[model samples]
Target: MKTIIIDDDATARLLIKKMCNAYSEIEIVSEFSNAVDAIKFLNKNDIEVIFLDIHMPLLSGFDFIKTLKKATKIILTSSDENYALEAFEYSKVVDYLVKPISKKRFEKSIHKLKSVIIKDSLVRDDSIFKEKQRNELYVSIERRLVRVPFSEINFVEAKGDYVKLKTDDESYIIHSTLKKIEAKLPSDNFLKIHRSFVINLSKIIDIKDNSVLLQKEIIPISKSRQIELITRLNIL
Candidate 1:
């Protein structure tokens, strides 16, 4: 993610940059001592994440969040733990780090950033960072929320703690269970043929023996759901 450090304290900025070095995903594009200059840079360029200081010389962290023109994820860093509650009130604020930030807590914040798939709202004026999630499934890949339409899904495979969403072009690994995702998918298209697999009925090429063929892949159909699958199909 293209990122920036916005803290008046040069030492604080250096520490944040050092902590961010552990993750390859975070690329520090620039650093700002004041929020006003950061806002100007934002107007001309696109930044994915921001490491902001709550107390600054020019504009405070809360004031800076209010000045954002578009949807962008922010991690607030402050010495005061008092603002943690107030910080969460803003949807753009992903994680609040109390300074001096610990290495373990920083790692947790990064993990949270990569796994956040849902939000009540992204930003004011309702600009949801090009991922509003309407009649679609939002998969968190890296630091972005990717939208996958139900029509493009060929099947879903359960992978322990995660589920793989197979599409015509690309496949995504989402942090969700098969049962939870099944509830979100429409009943007309998606059907659970097995405990570990859910297949899109329209994508099925043929059903042979106890398995169904979708595209080039063959998926097993459990005996318990065999009759249900047959009833759903238009058999001649």
Candidate 2:
């Protein structure tokens, strides 16, 4: 797995690097003295694990974690123990190691990293399989089966008992509920932004505050769905 070390202290960075070198599975891709440089590197590179220091010169480790677009496993190395509970609030933070870390403790952290990586890989593979199996959907319209490609769909809206499927060139009002059609759509491409609205993430032209612009229509995004939508986006 590719790994990066971020610590203000040169001695601390060296110690973590030396320990990580012992494990053949880990490859030290880069090291940084501050979170700013690390964030810059993270923007362009994909890393499996980050060995981070909780306290830094400018940006704290927790603040840095919030800036991440992709979900990457994090192991926090800090001298203080008071922030352990707070550190676990972030789902990506797998383990917290106190300063002067022992080899045994480091080994345990590595074990946790391996477990997370395996689980993530399985989930990714399952998602890929689902995507490969369902690329297009057939909808009943006027006694005819109309094939709609997932990529062409812009959004779906609830209109009384029926749902309207809006595409680039045309729109179809099917005799179905939004909930029913939502299940048929791929989760990676289609997201239920509101109780009445399911928007294709790729078709989004702009997102401002609580609303998203798709073609000419502005759909309101529910508060609950905002976090999920932001997580799906590759924001810098």
Candidate 3:
């Protein structure tokens, strides 16, 4: 994959570049000492993956991603491990690595490129499915079909004839059955939390006795689906 190195630390960037050089398929197009230069490069250049450092002067790795129009796979490199959970919030961030990265772990991170490909492919499929059913059952309220990232949706609530897609900021009521929408959703990121609810496992805030707190909504756990939800969720 075509790649770039964006880290404030010179040594860290060099190490990653060396590691990437070992692989025949990987290409190191550019390197930046700060996110601003990297952002500028990204604006014009085409890249598939980025090795970014979380802590940088002025512009952070997190902030740089926010400015991008096209999302590319990111692997965060840092001296500390505090930002691991926050890294997962971004769909583009595939992995987090601490400083002094070992060759073994570096290779593992490269292997994660396949996962990014899979997710991008699934989203393409979802787009095709939406276009096929666009005229079939769509709400007519000057509604815009927003691409709610798989990471943003908390859970879905099924009514009699429609399903409500609940996200972090808002909810949209689509004129469709749970089964149809469920088929379009990515199985790896989202789970059938309940018979009537499909939830994004990453957005789960807390898990109570018989319910899961997803964002601001609390979804019930059906007796039959509890085991399945447990398996899908990474509960600590």
Residue 203, candidate 3: C-alpha displacement in angstroms = 45
Each model's TM-score, in the order given?
Answer: 0.51, 0.58, 0.53
Question: Best candidate per lDDT, number?
Answer: 2
Candidate 1: what lDDT? 0.91
Ranking by TM-score: 2, 3, 1
How many clashes (backbone atoms < 3 Å, residues ≥3 apart in a chain or on different chains) does model 3 have? 0
Which digits, one per residue and each the tens of the lDDT, describe model 1 over residues 1-236?
A: 89999999999999999999999989999999999999999999999899999999978999999999777889999999999999999988999999999999999999987766233233432665333443577778888988888888999999999999999999888888999989888888889999999999999999999999998889999999999999999999
RMSD of 2: 11.5
Q: List ranges where model 2 is wrong by over 4 Å.
A: 136-236
**In candidate 2, what are the lDDT values of residues 103-211, reduced to their tens digit?**
9999999998899889989999999977865988889999999989999899999999999999999899999999999999989899999999999999999999999
lDDT for 139 (candidate 1)? 78
Q: Candidate 1 versus the native: TM-score? A: 0.51
Q: Candidate 3 residues 1-236, lDDT tens each? A: 78999998899999999999889888888999999988888878999889999999989989987887776888999999999999889888899999889999988988887667777889999999886554232333337656666656777789988889887787888778788877777778778878899888888888898999877788998889888878876556
C-alpha lDDT of all candidate models, in order: 0.91, 0.95, 0.83
Worst ten in a row by lDDT for model 1: 116-125
**How far out, in Å, is residue 17 in model 2?**
0.7
Candidate 1 regions off by >4 Å? 117-236
